[model samples]
Target chain A: MKIGIIGATGKSGSKIVTEALNRGHQVTALVRNKDKATKLFGGTVTIIAKDAFDITKQDLTNLDVVIDAFSVPLGKHLAYQHIDLAVHLVHLLRETETPRLVFILGAGSLQTDDGLLLDQLKKIPDSQAWIDTPESQTHELDFLRTVTNVNWVGVSPAASFVDGPKTDYALGKDHVLYDANQKSEVSTGTMAVAILDELENPSVHQARFTIRNK
Target chain B: MKIGIIGATGKSGSKIVTEALNRGHQVTALVRNKDKATKLFGGTVTIIAKDAFDITKQDLTNLDVVIDAFSVPLGKHLAYQHIDLAVHLVHLLRETETPRLVFILGAGSLQTDDGLLLDQLKKIPDSQAWIDTPESQTHELDFLRTVTNVNWVGVSPAASFVDGPKTDYALGKDHVLYDANQKSEVSTGTMAVAILDELENPSVHQARFTIRNK
Candidate 1:
């Protein structure tokens, strides 16, 4: 399948690109920095260097799937870009089912005993600096829920998302999943595998699913 | 004040353009049809012919206020454009305080004795034909509420938005308002006056207000 990954040079995005290529699927890295993408992928993947906001329908028409792994740096005041980019992409893809969109969301949107994980994050000391990232992503999921005509799905990581290799994973809908050891976390590799598995098999639609290392 | 009105050729939008012109403010008709706008206002208002989605921030930077009076016709399958266009305008104006945005929303988002007016609208027989308009507008308001950095406000007319001249009007926040004789309606003229008054006085901020004939 032809796959386009926005923010393909980012942490989780690079892993997804590698996983997709290893599976023999064609990959297109949609990034703002062509030099960085070429350096990272080393001519293994096609690169379209354009800001996410400037990506047009013509650029996405040939792809079977598009993964939105776009992120703003934590502690920056530009976290609202998460929600803005999501809305831009969704608006461009309205009334179509092809080129399925997969949004990589944050764990803050997951359900917890004390309501949303975002509610707890707000209580942490000095969370104001980075809280907007999760809050904007939470709003992104909420906006996606109202959309019915678009073929889109959201994925949320567990409380701790870190860089690591693949592992056996557990999946839950809307909730914060805990492993047997009472840890709620997922690695970049596990997330990539779970996302590719879901894309190939196609289970969830217009809703969010969470993953944790099991 | 210089003001821009999207959909200035439409029913309520035309009235707004007239009211703004009457108040001696320079009005620009940011419309899709230049001929139609020219036929409506002739040389009275400057016209920028472009799709609402294609409207850019550069075109809006000079205006003191931009009224989003864009609408899709009833019973059309393109009702989702309401939410899409709202998101587009808000995204363009993010992180800015200039060019206050006034969104002309639907009453379906207003609260009623039974949950929301949208819930009641959904129960009407054969409403499927026109329900998408209200449903999408409701979602538009939901999306706007999450935006914090933009200087935006929403105005919803009463249950029966009709074509007539301006009259005595009363305002309420969030809830559906009714007139003394139990009619829930507002003339396009009243809506225009109320909107112009609000734009001039700047009473509401980052919230929605409803109006009815009193």
Candidate 2:
């Protein structure tokens, strides 16, 4: 498979690039800084530095799948930036003839009993830094859902998304991710694996699902 | 109308108490800290100090509407402390024969196309702090929707929840609130008014709705 990863230098994005490469798939690492990408990712994959929106159909024309791990800061109000990127990507991918998209979403959108989004994050303290990232991801998901022509899958993490290796976990659609103790904690490696699996198998098309340790 | 305001000493909770009082409604302010309640609220309404979990039918036996402004953190890996409070309040309200519940929710649960929670926010430079509170409120809405016996309405503010007088904005259900400019914003005072009006009129029952400028 040919894969293009946006924000390939990011913690989670880098994992996706490496894992895709390790699987013997051809990977194009889309990044903002080539120097940072080289320092973090080394010369393991093909690296392309371009603005997410500026990348034309020619940029994505040959890729079988596009994985966006692009990031902005936590707590910066950039709904338009994120949403713009998603909308632009949908447009760009459609024009480029790309068929599949796999998005990294936040755990906050999991269904409460009545289907209200858990994005308000009242359960988490305000002092934490990563809280806002979920909101940005959710906004992008909303925009993507409006694009019916695009086949996309939005994957959210568990409530506690710590940095660690993958574990034995299960996945559920439109629900919270639970671990062996039924607690929600997912590692980035597992999340990337789940994304790659989804990218390969093509389930959960145009839907959102969560993955956690079983 | 007779209204009960839970967690009436915190920032938004205290504001709820005042709004209920100003609207000429009989208000019962529930809180844990009597000293803070006394110092901050100063007897503008009836104050009942008790552990939120211990709130009983007798405490709410007389109220017509319960505006649960009470809140607790979602904890490190927990959904929210308020989830228990919401469940407890619904249980008590059902026993006490109270008819309606008006909950203040965070916007985190608002859905994008991929069904991600909007509240899982990432900070973008030049964004405001108030934009993320709606996600938490959305979680509360989810908890409230599970109860069949209680009539409830969850009010989520726009992306920017400004503190000001009422503006009489338009209302939306299960979608982001956007203005003519496509940017979303709302005032806390207007959110209070809309919630109060919903309590009095009782439209869009058992659903989550949003408020934004006209």
Best by lDDT: 1
List, for all models, the DockQ compared with the true complex: 0.73, 0.02
* Model 1 stretches with alpha carbons more than 4 Å out: none
Q: Which ten residues in a row have the lowest lDDT in candidate 1 chain A?
A: A75-84
Interface RMSD in Å per candidate, to 1 decimal? Answer: 1.0, 16.6
Residue A133, candidate 2: alpha-carbon lDDT = 57
lDDT of 2 by residue, B89-164 (tens): 6645542335577777766666655464463364444323443233434545654554444677777777677777
What TM-score should be assigned to candidate 2?
0.49
DockQ of candidate model 2? 0.02
Clashing pairs in 1: none
Error of 2 at B5 (Å): 49
TM-score of every candidate:
0.99, 0.49
TM-score of 1: 0.99
Give fnat for candidates 1, 2 and onward, in order: 0.53, 0.00
Model 2 residue B195 lDDT?
79
